[model samples]
Target: MPQPPIVHTHRKPLVYALVWASLPAATLAQEAQPTVLDAIQVSAERGEPASESTSSYTAASSRTALKLALSHRETPQSVSVITRKQMDDFAQTDVNDVLEGTTGVTVESVETDRTYYTSRGFNIDNFQYDGVGLPAVYDNVQGDLDTAFYDRVEVLRGANGLMTGIGNPSATVNFIRKRPTVANRASVAVTGGSYDNRRIVGDVSGAVTASGKVRGRVVAGYQNRDSYLDRYNNEKQMFYGVVEADLTATTVLTLGHASQTSDTDSPLWGALPLFYSDGSPTHYQRSTSTSADWSYWDNVQHNSFAELSQQLGGGWQAKGSVLRLEKDSDSELFYQYGTPDRQTGEGLFAYPSQYELNTEQWVADAYATGPFSLVGRIHELVLGATWSRSETVDESRYGQGIGTALPPLEEWTGSYPKPTFDNGISGSDWTDKQTSTYAAVRWTLADPLTAITGVRLTWLDSEGVSYGLSKATRYNAVETPYAGLIYDLSHNHSVYASYTEIFKPQTEVDRDRNRLDPIDGVNYEVGLKSDYRAGRLKSTVAVFHTEQDNLAEAAGTFDNSVDSYYRGVDGLTSEGIELELAGEVSDRVQLFAGYTYVDIDTANGHTAKPSIPAHLAQLRATWRVPGTTGLALGSQVRWQSAIRQNQGTVSGGPNDGQPIVTRQSSYAVLDVMARYDFARNWRAQLNVNNVTDEKYIESLKKFGTSAQGFYGAPTNANVTVSWTY
Candidate 1:
């Protein structure tokens, strides 16, 4: 349950750094006034340049690792920033779209309303808002999280044990919210795209008081879209509002709320079969739908938060925040199983059910950061504590006629009768409480070398009933440590190494019905980073290794046991290398590019998690038209290596017991964009994605003869018009 230090860097800086290299010569020559000094200080402390108005593809600095603002060249691990400009240029409306374009990350859209993300051969379960952590929803994201309310998204690509509870070695995602601006600003955008997709968004921010000490901001958006799949449609609405007040010269207060709702019709519970009864692959039209007409999935989420900050003088500050989040899910789903006959189009059966889930979480955090003189040199330190509690309840109802055979596939129209849910609810209720205290220090070991060391102590307790089974456990003083060293080779380059640890509690039971112990892991990373054009452009080459112990491996059920069990595993390792370059490339060009390679193996030398691609590459670039005003063009390409999974043969058939392997070959997708400004405050843009109309599967696990395999989206285009003031 170890969590990150809750340092509130969103406030004004406690100190200032004066660097003349990156600044314009004219501005740098005459900027010693107190007001100008404050502006410069704020730029250094805000973690990163606010991406809302910046048209750059990269940021100057970020603090996702230890809450200490550091430039990209100083961080010891890999990090990526998805800016608002990039999102707008590419029409990235949701979290899934943003992550799919990021380097070294994969978005696994396994179903219509659910998604999972992976990096470095592990699942990403750590998510944060600003600096506060949010508990994941059972290891997956279940709703459509829009990006209209965020200023930017920062992704740390390694074990961030110092700043998260689970210490997952995969990655951590931090969403920075758009704050109220002192200057009045407003914008509105309308977009239309393929598949009957239409969207509109509005944003307003300005001073709410005569003295300009109080400011408020609001953002709202609505979207309706129909998919290429038959009978599938989705509608979503999102809202965000925030207010800020300066109570004193050195004290500030902020309050905010956010809500979103999503509704989908004919949402699929499972994918189409990949193989036929004769042991050959089955091909279906891209528009085919296996979901029943009555099936639907609906989700809603709400978040409320408040924070207070005060300046204590002497380059020190203190901050505290509280957040509460609630989520609800409802669904009626249809699933089809069994491989069909190639000639007869028979052998498929249906299973239908109704399900509901509700989850709520609360977190309170406070921290202090300041500068100290250590051995005649200035260093920084952060001390903080966090407390959080989460509760989840879920239930499912079995519908009548769950095992009815489907009609012939060639003529299927999803006209199966809706089933009646007469069975009682059957599900689980669970709760978790965690408390943690952490401290970290950045030591100025030398003029060109710095060391970062931190430790966290956590206490966790869980108690509740889960599916007719007892779920009671306690852990105390779970200590996790972090260490890193950064050596500056020059003003524009650095080399770094880091070590961190992470742990996760397990609920899987053994054959004897005993709960398995928590899984633990460690991560090691070394990299070289280069900065160009005064940090306007950056590059990184990193090599990383991760190891996990006590992993859970599935074990078949024993006598009288209806549920399958698992045993502890040891020595699971993943190693990888990553290369990335991002930021302004030239006077009239901007770019973001990356390549990743990863391999996972068990102790016995066999490959693990084969469904994940071993190679990934991406490039996105934009260029201003030569000798033209307010005109730009962009292009993007994403490619991944082949992936495969073995599903075993169909039962009671001629090929029974034979190996069934499903594979997806290497594929690449291309996208293009064009934008023009006809007026000072008005502009229009167009984007075309998957220009090649590549046909490929989105994911491979749980995809075989019986069920579960989804196709990627086909060629699509969208146009947006916006006016700003």
Candidate 2:
């Protein structure tokens, strides 16, 4: 990413117009004095780009947690930034893949194409494009965004209601896009891997005007690959283009567009059954898949955005941005689940389903920041406003009759005949709208102590019409406040304490068939942040506690003639501690390591959330050979404690008399990478994942007796060759 300098000024349009009007005369004068023009060009080229940073793996500053740029030591919340170098070394291709290696974050796949991310015992439902927040909906189409067009991904842990108007208390993820650069640059790469995988990518960027004030960039990529599973294959295509212009010395303008499409054939709808009809656990091969040959899932996304930034006098700046996003998806899937007889596989069943959805969203935000004098002390202040709206239309259909019987397990193949179905019924049409005004101030209370306080006034409205239901919900004039205090223990160490709030509207119904009120919560955290080796290395140790009320849970029982309902729980609490270290440890060594422990419980203990491990740790290190130039090797290790799901009791089956307390034993995975600059302008690299080929379950259903668990990927490797010009 490359950005123009931040400008703070008034009368931006007038200033730019005057500058453009004088360009001809300035050019003529410069032509007459070549020496003066050369000096000016050199000075201009020396100016640093706003988006490019000198840090190798650590970020110097971020604006995701708060709308103001702050360093890691200054921010009160835990933040993780994955830079371009890390993504390339880890071979991360998509948003989900990147988060999988991120600290304190967990990724789970419900199906082949549907993925979910969680942090600190809650689901992460807040996402941003640049600095603008977007609606977070848990649809299959929203989680497969590609990372080719992004420069980096930033994750802020814990509650962030000050910036994101309505969201869960987990965390917020921000994707920063790449921008045009002032200098000419181009690169191309080709990759080949196991399962017949192949991919190619090209990028080009340069100035379009002789004055070097106007620049443009374009990136394109294509990939096609076969999976380890039978009959499963995927193809992806992506494109991105951006144009930037220096309207004036103090003003910059940017416009960009991006698009991605994924086409997957023979996609799996669900995992295979875990138990046999005789109450015995069954074992399946790592490559076993429950998909039919006719299954397919296809999705397409398009995004367009514009931004304007102006430098105001006296350390002040103003910036504004608008973004529009549209996504469409169509999927046809076949699922296999049900107990199978030990010998005949008599009870095996198949389910076929299809769905289509179209979603569109628009977001706009503007902010101004500058220094102000209060009580003879200069303080930093920021004020901003944001508006967002989203709408989704979906249609779906499922097989009407009873499940179709499948062949014996030993004789089953993936070439089942495609089933014919009727036209799908209209599913749901919904719209969400939100608006907010926010302000924050960095108060200089003393020489070594500073306080940050912020507040947001929000208005939200949601309306929807479903197959057999219609409803409207509104939260008007809600207020969320934030407060934090930081004390410098030393030049390289800081201790901070912060408090934040959370507000999320739930659609769950009560025993009377009425929707429950919104859930409210508060988060408290105390942490120590440190920077070493001139900010090249960063580390944090934090402890956090969160409590929520009015949590919706299942009611004891429901009347046969009426729909089931939920009841609000009085108390729900989650406590956790996290430790992380990331960045270059030495000139030849780069390292990243993290550890987390979390405990969550409900007042009644009967409705506790599951699938969250009690402990998790991750470590990765890369070393460049001291004697061999352009040669580097890296290794990574990830481990998690056991995860248990309390399924309560089985209903009516071979294991009816037993309790379904399913547990997945602890697991660990290893990965290795090597890169060598074999030539002047060319390089080759290899990445091997799951080095030991560990086999384990990645996700398990509450009722483990059912067939609803996902398996981890087996060992695989890829080789890539890249060229730069």
Candidate 3:
């Protein structure tokens, strides 16, 4: 049946123009507002920002770190940069909110900043800053970085053998610190909303000396928020400062420090059972209150960085960075498991436990890159070497295995009624030391094309100390290779491709008790780039493939596992196509859209690899009425294909082909935001997330034959107010 079409009532141009003019006049007479430029500051190199579009190429501009960390397209590898402008507009506090829509990037929330990033089919446990590489502390020590401290984030999509030599060929992320500019600016903000939350933040930066040689920037913030999960609440505060000095006409040095502390009322190791005699979601009946006396823990993090650069004679320049990062977490945790009863509202539990944990990590590195001459010809080159070491120690044993549901909601606090694994996982320690040497160069084969080649060799040694035994494994030096090309399609566009090597040392050993060969990976990628704005719009589309050898398989847990818990290089493959379009339609209207199609397979014969999805699409549009400059509105839509659970069943169960439950059902999520210019120095904005209130599962904790579930959150939004003087 066709519906009737029809009526167009048009407002006269004279009337519309008159209303538009009157509105602004009235606003100006009653309130003075900030300029539109106040909401955004972009470092879109080459006038075009890199997004997921195949038509443009983008690179991180040393500024705008976390702000546009999710937007840029720079390398043949898929890279996402979420900009501070985007963060301010959406008031994104958690990194999860900023990355949930990235192509091939899955943001799985275990808790607040404990969210994890999974690409293709693996977790990113190594991260770099400036030029320093750090061991990503997840299991034992995990912490969050306040977005306010970053200028921008640079992401290289494939094996970053040249930058961070220890990780996957799947991806790498770098956080570039914000430097002091030759300008003075200061701002502050306060916020309040759902769950009795409150927060405050401040940012200050500018030239501190008359000569502008000595400049500094600082950012500090604090927040307290109660959550909806039982025994869950989070409070945090952070301080970040950076200072720079120009000692000579051609030399620059920068020193910076960041520190943060967070106390969580309660954080679950994993959700309780989600099923009972019948199959249904238990979350619906569980207590909304958090534990009264539980401690997820209060953690602190610190990063110290120093960088120096000098211009040698000729076209040669050398730069290097020395940095260190530390994370510490200590807490006691207890909780029960179960699905909520359909009628009683009480969650039924099948297992429960009490535990305590303490974790710490520290890493340091230094490297340099520059251009030089070989013979009489000029050679664009990069040369560097680095060393890193880390140690992880955990203490505990388990308790009595839980066999039934948890008690009533009122009994939410206290030590676990019975613990598992005996005394708990106590006196467990693992230490690793790695060193790398690398050198690379880019040659201009012609006016239209450039080629890059590089290699990294690393040596690794790790030891486990526990009980009365210490087991150690040492890997002789291993060499990794790389090569890439960029062919200019034109001044504003290019066709580029590259192949790079990757490797990750095994934490668990193989049969015969020898350290297994590291997992090796190779990445291949090709794409195009563009520049549209006098220097603003950016776009890109590309295809990538990665093959990893010796993927891990657990015969047991991260601790006690059966012999040969690790396998030799088998076959693990991932291939995908990505596209993105972003930039200004006008000074007031901005648009960004991205799409990703993936084809990933596991020779181990599993279908779904953890958090990776097959398809993802997203679009966002912001329209600041051209004439009514005081008001702005924006909307976004994100969708992904259904995810398969690749878990195989055992004896009484099934095989590998059987997937776990759908944790993320390729559902479309919506988000909205609006900003109002209240006065010259103040602005107000509202942000809404998960607007559709869709029911989804984020992850499933499987214990052999037992599988329990945890439900994802529905709609959650917050409001923000800001001011400047």
Using TM-score, give the best candidate's number.
Answer: 1
Residue 105's lDDT in candidate 1: 93
Q: Clashes in model 1: which pairs?
A: 4-163
| Model 2 lDDT, residue 288, Cα | 78
Instruction: lDDT for model 2, please.
Output: 0.77
Question: Per-residue lDDT for 359-414 in model 3, tens only?
Answer: 44444444443343332333455556677777766554444554545565444454
Better of 2 and 3 by TM-score: 2
Candidate 2 local Cα displacement, residue 172, angstroms: 0.5
For model 2, residues 633-706, the per-residue Cα lDDT tens digits are: 99888898887665455556566767655567899999999999999989999999999998888776332223
Residue 653, candidate 2: C-alpha displacement in angstroms: 6.2
Predictions in order: lDDT? 0.82, 0.77, 0.60
Give one digit per residue, the lDDT tens place, for model 1 in 634-708.
999999999887666666667777777778899999999999998999999999999999998887754222235
Q: Model 2 — which ten-residue stretch has the worst lDDT?
A: 37-46
Query: Candidate 3: where are CA atoms >4 Å away?
Result: 1-74, 111-113, 138-141, 277-293, 335-365, 373-378, 397-405, 408-425, 466-471, 509-516, 554-569, 604-611, 646-664, 700-709
What TM-score would each prediction reach against the true structure? 0.91, 0.89, 0.81
lDDT of 1: 0.82
Alpha-carbon deviation at 26 in model 3, angstroms: 68
